[model samples]
Target: MKQLLEILGFIALVQGVAGLVHEFTDWDWGFVQRLDVLDGYEVYASVALLVLGCALLAAAESRASR
Candidate 1:
């Protein structure tokens, strides 16, 4: 369970960073930018993903210390 959280967190973090980078640099990358539903809200979605990733990682760490 902890491992799963860690893995998910890592993926989210990567994607979030990628999304932000793409938005700022026009790099043409990341899954967030490719979503039609998030046409004008990619930045917000990326920020949410970044926060979720941090939360998941923190949860995994707490679980590990248990």
Candidate 2:
């Protein structure tokens, strides 16, 4: 479970980074402007996933330590 969570976190982080790249390359709107409606969503979701995954991994680790 811990390993799974870690993997998920890594995936999320990578996806978030990709989203950021997409947003940066998008010229339809200026940076920090309307980005949230576009690729920014990916960033947000991926960040959330990463945080959740990390937390899960931490919990698993703690449990294993017991």
Candidate 3:
């Protein structure tokens, strides 16, 4: 379970970072930019992903220490 969380967190973190980078630099990457539903809300979604990633990582760490 902890491993799963960690993996998910890592993926989220990568995607979030990629999204932000793409927004700022027009790097042409990340799944955020490919979503039609998000449209003008890519930044917000990216930020949410970033936060979710952190939370998942923290949860994984706490689980590990148990």
Residue-level error in angstroms, candidate 2, position 6: 0.4
Q: What is the RMSD of candidate 2? A: 6.4
TM match of model 2 to true structure: 0.47
- Model 1, stretches more than 4 Å misplaced? none
lDDT of each: 0.96, 0.56, 0.96
**lDDT (10s digit) by residue, model 2, range 2-45:** 67766665665555555456556753422323444644365565
Give the total clashing residue pairs for model 1. 0
Tens digits of per-residue lDDT for model 1 on 1-66?
999999999999999999999999999989999999999999999999999999999999999999
Which candidate, 1 or 2, has the higher TM-score?
Answer: 1
In candidate 3, list every pair of residues with a backbone clash.
Answer: none
Residue ranges of candidate 3 with Cα displaced over 4 Å: none
